[model samples]
Target: MSELPLNPRSPLLPDRHPEPDFFVADIFDATPKGDQASMEHPLFTLATKPDMESQEYRHGDIFVNIGPSPIGRATVHDRDILIYCISQMMARINEGRKVSRTMRFNPHDLMVVTNRDVSGRGYLNFKQALKRLQGTQIETNIQMGGKEQWNVFSLIADATIVRETRDGRMQEVEITLSNWLFDAIEAKGRDLLTLHRDYFRLRKPLERRLYEIARKHCGHQKSFRIGLQRLQEKAGSQSSIYEFRRLISKIVSDNASHQHIPEYDFAFDGDFLDIYRREEGGALPSPAKRGLIVSDSARERAKKHAKGWDIYALEAEWRDWVTSKAIEVQNADAHFVTFAKQRGPYKR
Candidate 1:
């Protein structure tokens, strides 16, 4: 990664590209594939620069879907690409193009962007604009007579912050999909692959190099040799990193961890080591990363408890030790030993 300018609001991720297969021809259609298709009908929105950055909690599921390891893999098969693919959909709308596709209850395109500034005001404004044109031909018209017909609809400012639970309970905690993307983009520039590298600019040297690595991982993160193995386990998730920092930033404010350790590097799902090796041409090993690799014996010991624990579970315990102890928890290894040993021999 390049020398970051230390700007808190810096654009974390470079530009993204569109996905090859945007979506199922009929999102609502139930094929033999068996995935639950929504019958709510397809909806379209236009993505704008503002929507790129925002904090909304409706994103937990979206982030899980588009991140390295989606909660439901089928929903967002290629997350990084999905990032740009969404932008592409937006561009199509901006260009006054027509998007004719079958739909059910799925976002037909990545048109609904979360503005990078002001808590999703762009999307919010867009949505308001939408409700106004309900009766006129302007319903979904983004351009008056330009090209694309994308129309902005409604946006929720900090939309997810005040959501109601299934039990009809409301909470003040709000999160957004843009926040997740911002974290993912900022934490590590490793996955901004060349697939669409031309779209973004990285001013920091460290960040630039990191993107080089991210580009590599996207190709093989799913490969059997290293891809699936990653699912074996990893340090922790990026959100964990943010939670650690947010806890402290609210206290005595120090910018030490300003550059957080992105979830990709330590997290189990991202292929940090693989991309590093490939990026560095197998020389100049990343000692810190290599050190994290467990010996087969240690790994075997950990695996024995795999039923009840994994490396990540230990790290989570380490994190909870204290949002107050981000430094201590830094050594996830200490946690591995402490946690793995406590598991004792499995009940064979």
Candidate 2:
């Protein structure tokens, strides 16, 4: 058998906490989840350096205005903190524990899970990210958690370094999520998506944004196609069409060679980008065709059966499994409940 060649370039970020035991005891097994609202919009900047620019995006009736603080608009990298907190909250929910908007955790744990640096410099960067998150103001009409009211809020309502090391590095961190974000998390199944753990290891801001778009829109479907101009708008890239095309070509070529972008593969056909799932299963059927509607009662039962597992994630997996196995499920809800019961619980 011919062997696949190894990637020639080194990974952009090293695995800071390679050992399983390195994470905090409570959240070592947490699966990363990204809020659907931010994933769908251009809430973050792609600039590697501090970006002191205000931007506006309008899609139909939804309008978003983002204003940056002096330090910069919150970059995509800064979103990692929010992802970590969201993951923690989801984990708690799966375990049937109550979760509040405000969260407290060891700063090291955040860094470890996000594949970030743990040095003194890393702590300083963490502090800066918190500042950007708290200072960047957003005004939007988008509703989250079913609340539909206009509001201006920062990414985080508040943040504090609760403890510090002798060298002045932050030890403990507490963050109060903005009402907008907190509402999304509280909405549960409708407002969050599971992220591939390697999302933290992506080298470029554009790459990260692209992955978020795919993870949000393509999801578990067989494929999703979008026009290049439309994709540029979704990605919030400031580059012109020509420059964006060049950048995307480079990314497409790189991903083709390295296969580093997780979950999905990318291809460009003329002016449209095609996103295809890497797995071999066929596309999921429509809910109507598959009788895929799960009753509230069934959801409760599945939760009990798959304790500590995100029920929506399991549903996605169940759908993929059904398609892959060519199972003609007559009673989708009952079959999913059985699948959950058989899959059993996972350690939180």
1-348: candidate 2 lDDT, tens digit per residue: 222223345434566777746347567678999988888889999998899999999889999999997799999999999999999998998899999989999888888889889898998899999999999999999989898999999999999889988989887889999989988788875788999899999989999998999998899897899999989998999998878876886676456545678877776743788898888465343343554545557768998999976565566567657766888877766898999999899875
Per-residue lDDT of 30-115 in model 1, one digit per residue for the tens? 11110010000011111211122222112112211111111111111112223433333333444666432111122212221211
lDDT of 1 at 48: 18
**All models: lDDT?**
0.27, 0.82
Q: How far is 314's C-alpha from truth in model 2 (Å)?
A: 40
List TM-scores for all candidates, in order: 0.23, 0.77
What's the residue-level lDDT of 220 in candidate 2? 85
Find the 10 residues in a row with the least total lDDT in model 1. Answer: 33-42
Worst lDDT window (10 residues) for model 2? 1-10
lDDT of 2: 0.82
